[model samples]
Target: MPRPTSRWIAERASVGTSTVRRPDRTTWIVLGRAGADVAVVFLDAEDVELGRRTVGADSWATWAAEIEAGEAVRWVWNDTPRWYAELLAAGTRLARCHDLRLCHAILRDSALVRADADLRVHTDWDATPHADPPAAAPTLFELGAAPDAATGLPEFLDDAVREFARQRTAIDGSTDPGRLRLLTAAESAGALVAVELRAAGLPWDPQAHDRILRGVLGPRPAAGGTPMKLEDAGRRVRAALGDPSANLDSQPKLLRSLHRAGVLVESTSRWELAQYRHPVIEPLLEYKKLSRLLSANGWAWLDEWVHDGRFRPVYVPGGVVTGRWASSGGGALQLPRQLRGAVHADPGWCLVIADVAQLEPRVLAAMSGDRALADAARGKDLYAGIVDTGAVATRAEAKIAMLGAMYGATTGDSGRLVPRLRRTFPRAMALVDDAAREGENGGVVSTWLGRSCPAPSAGWHAAQSLASAVEASGGDETRARRWARDRGRFTRNFVVQGTAAEWALAWMADLRGRLAALDAVPDSDAAPRSGAVFSTRPHLAFFLHDEVVVHAPRERAEAAALAVREAAASAARLLFGDFPIDFPLDLRIAESAQDD
Candidate 1:
């Protein structure tokens, strides 16, 4: 059996074989850096069932000290249960490492495991129901009991997905992706993920669902704990929606619970607080602190998330590249590993954080078969190295300009800078420019893998054609000339952005698959199981931009770090097999959310 991602993670981190991969892994391990205090074990996706345990009740610090004293340990990788996750269509199978033993049982009844089952399903997210003309009041019809989803959705796929991702990347590169639509998607998905988690018998953030309902359902009145009639609340909803002056009486329990959990804050009678924080909101104070760091030092604010004991980040599917994902809501991509001070050891615990560096760009170079570009990046930063090869002035400037060029960043410093970069690096610039031009023309793009960017609409085509005609007339003064500029900009960047997104999706999928074989456990606490010490699954709890957070224990923490790195390495291998590009990662360990 090709081992799963977690087992792969453990084996690579320590100089040992894992049972999941090599039968050699089943043999007793020779002592290594992680020491005896930690060991490899197994658990369900939620980490609720018992499998195996390694350490005694001693604090993690005590075990670390013992490892320093020379002993080898093999415990299961255990962390918190993501029992609450459910709303996702693809489900957790895409992001987490699973035991074939466990997955076989879990998926026994699931459609995914059924040999005859089809994988595609369609929603009206991209349907042109509104194509006829914008209606003042769009028809509100019941969409109960979804029909079998549309097949060959690639036919229906539009440029929205890739365009959005590129816009996001450019925006992410320039500024924080503060409280955008994706945040809503992530939070909503998280709420559903929470539901599934609860079904798995883990701690469900009831407070989260309650917040969702309260937002949809107006506030409640001050009454006893008796259940309020839905009719009572319905009346309140009518009153709130109709009356201009009447204050919305939110469900005190849900609203107050969110307030207590730090998930929400009340800004005024009309609105509840969001994680993004706005002026006049409670989350604003925290938001401002992060914004200041991002604006001034860029990524310096990541230390703030290191507090609260463990890094619990959320993972979004299709969050980035064409089939990619984004992680701003949970700070998945933006971690401050060098500042392990943010993570703590509890009184006797320790923190371990590590990552694979040069991931996406390296994947790009390898995928594109640009040996010259890959060779230039063989032993140094790709951008910095690119600057050295044929760029002028600072390496940072070259990198910025190149990235900006690839993503259709125009009219700014990156815009001004990209032309110079193009002049110096013709081949590299030509590739990105070609991709960008495809998007502008409403054409589809693809990743090294077969993932395709969506196409444009008929209206979009008409708009572009009109713009082209005006430009062709050589009359910059015409109104049509002015209109075409907008179309030109959109088309210019679409393909490149879309293709980049496609690459991201494949990278995540490949990484998830490879890491599953590793059995990367954490060194955290364990809840009991039947005669066995089933450790908690190292659940992802938060995500931002490109970083992921795993709430792990000391025993499994190092393994988790190994998983993060190997998964990335595997992603590179999966995309380009073997190339001249090198992707390196940085590492850090911490004990709390406030690591700084």
Candidate 2:
């Protein structure tokens, strides 16, 4: 097992697992299918069954709302979209949940768990979440039968109870149960947020989107015809190449054309093409840029994604191996900056747009307990602070050096400048170095919150073993060394990047609750297009990796901004308690997200 490297984790371990305790009033309600009705099993903090009840399909939503209104409870369910989507559409918003699928994935593979943990046993809980798109309307009762095997996850009452028990046992018996507990909670909360984000879709302006596309692409092309600007750029590129009939879209043909034109480039990639001073470079780059926009977020995309004044993207929680969320559809993660103007607030609403500055490095400083790095990142620009420390002569160098140190860059200017950072911030450098060494030796490494990277593949072990044998050839050694270094680079960055993702999740989860607590506006002032539960309230509208946009009534915009800042502070404290690191945001309040 990989040792815990975080000071906060060590401190938490010292304080014992009592820190995992929940509020006294909180109940754990497990819900699953019981024939045509919904089976509900209530448990207290001690994992003892408090009671059980079965509600008919017709009254499930109403009964759930009543139970939610009564006291603090965290619902445990098979899947978030399967259960929560209908609730939100029926105007029921949950405070918290334990998504068995998401949590099982976390605890089962966590490095902190015992190797013999029962949760590690192969089961249906290991199945991925179902792929069906969330229903737009309330269908809790109408969609009657329980999910079949095709849905991926099991939905029987017995399955939920057994899986929940196994997860609790794994956490309770883990080497660092507190950290695993926190990770599971955050992961489950992310599942809830994913569904809610779809429910309260991002406010979008289709007219503004079309206008931006027109301004950039020079008008939407008719079917089977290219836009004017794209066509002109293509014409310029072909003219520069002196091959009027050149096929710019075909890489092989384009390369051959470039070679014939004395461009002598090996490939058509923009970077390789830029190294030469050919007249074709500028227009070729421009053509590729415009072409990407045309295909990615073009007129076709606008017609498909945006509907009823909202863009609802499917968010897949824990979609990345690093525990980061990924978009399953609608290209939410790749929304281009050119279309920012299209993310418009409603008539009576404003957007609180905020994103962290230098988030990953700040996380690295705090997690590694490098007080010098933390002091530099306390309340201002982290790279500028590195410059003040004399680690590098310029802020640009400081940025490059810090990134190189974290990413294991070993060549060029980044490689040359990284030594200065190592000398100045040895503690921070040591953490990644140790992780790299571990990976090079075929060991697993974990993040601050205990999400472990996958172990080395069998091929990796075979190559390493073969290279160590007596009759190993020069070629075998070379390939083995190269693979080791690649794995080292991956593991070196995984700890920092994965922890940074956890911090971001903590930030969003806390902010989600704070925004929910704000007073709702009058129904007349509501942005009714936002959907049933979110129409009258301030809610999260959009989220990238390190940024969030909150759609709020103009009256609550300031409060929402404050909540955004407060949430950053809270997330830092949650991950690295009492550590002097800060996550500063470049925040703005505007009617259009483009203003920021």
The candidate maximizing TM-score is 2
Deviation in Å, model 1, residue 584 alpha carbon: 1.0
Per-residue accuracy of model 2 over 1-596 as CA lDDT, tens digit each: 33322222213212222232333546677887655567666666766555555677788788778666765678998778888888888889998999888888888778999999987884657767654435334322223445545332224654677788999999999999999989999998888898999889999999999999888889888887899999999999999999899998889999898898898888777788889998988999999989999899998998998999999998988999888889978899998899999999999899999999998899889889999999888778999999888889999999888888888999989999988888999899999999999999999999999999999999999999999999999999999999999999899999999999899899999999999999999999999888989999899988899999999999999999999999999998999999888899999999998953
Residue by residue across 294-347, what tens digits does model 1's lDDT show? Answer: 333232223332223333344344444343434433344554343322333333
Indicate the residue-level lDDT of 412 in model 1.
67
Ten-residue stretch with the least lDDT total in model 2: 4-13
TM per candidate comes to: 0.46, 0.91
TM-score of 2: 0.91
Tell me, what's the RMSD of every candidate?
Answer: 18.4, 7.6
